[model samples]
Target: MTTNHLELSGRILRSRRFDSPAGIHHTVLQLEHKSLKTEANMQRQVYCVIQVILSGERFERLTDKLKAGVDIQVSGFIALQQSRNGQSRLVLHAENVELKN
Candidate 1:
């Protein structure tokens, strides 16, 4: 089986909560990441913003903790989400989220 997992640390740029028709609670977060890495024996600076989805009742308790400007770490798998306009974007489905000091 192939593996698809990713872990990223970043600051929350935005956060919103909503409930599905099925009554499941969901929270979406916009995360911004900046880092430096060595590539081909050279240092490179990287920056990106990604959306993160946290679903289920367990995550509702964390809603208050997820806010803009807060630093956090999230780990999960990435998936393609299609919008009603037929546009597709990559989103991270967070299985775990932790606040950074």
Candidate 2:
């Protein structure tokens, strides 16, 4: 068996809500993260921007709070999504979201 899980904390750079043709609600967030980490036994600064997607009615309650500039932590799985142009990118599908003080 294999497992795929990830947890990340970052500031929301952008947020948007949309409905699919089947009426499924989806919330997309662009998150920016900056932190210091130990790599190769040395301290290094890490910075990244990633896309997070929250889907279904279960995440409705948290949608309103997923606004730009809000600091939040999200726990979920990562998947590759292909766009219309056939380019694939990594996206985090959030299962849990929390506000960070």
Please name the candidate that would achieve the greatest TM-score relative to the true structure.
1
List where candidate 2 sits over 4 angstroms from the true fold. Answer: none
Candidate 1 regions with alpha-carbon error over 4 angstroms: none
Question: Could you tell me the C-alpha RMSD of candidate 2 in Å?
Answer: 0.7
Which residue pairs does candidate 1 place in steric collision?
A: none
Worst 10 residues of 2 by lDDT: 60-69
- For candidate 1, the 10 contiguous residues with the lowest summed lDDT are 56-65
- Residues 1-98 of candidate 2 have per-residue lDDT tens digits of 99999999999999999999999999999999999999999999999999999999999988998899899999999999999999999999999999
The whole-model C-alpha lDDT of candidate 2 against the native structure comes to 0.96
lDDT of 2 at 57: 99
Evaluate model 1: give its TM-score. 0.97
Instruction: lDDT for model 1, please.
Output: 0.96
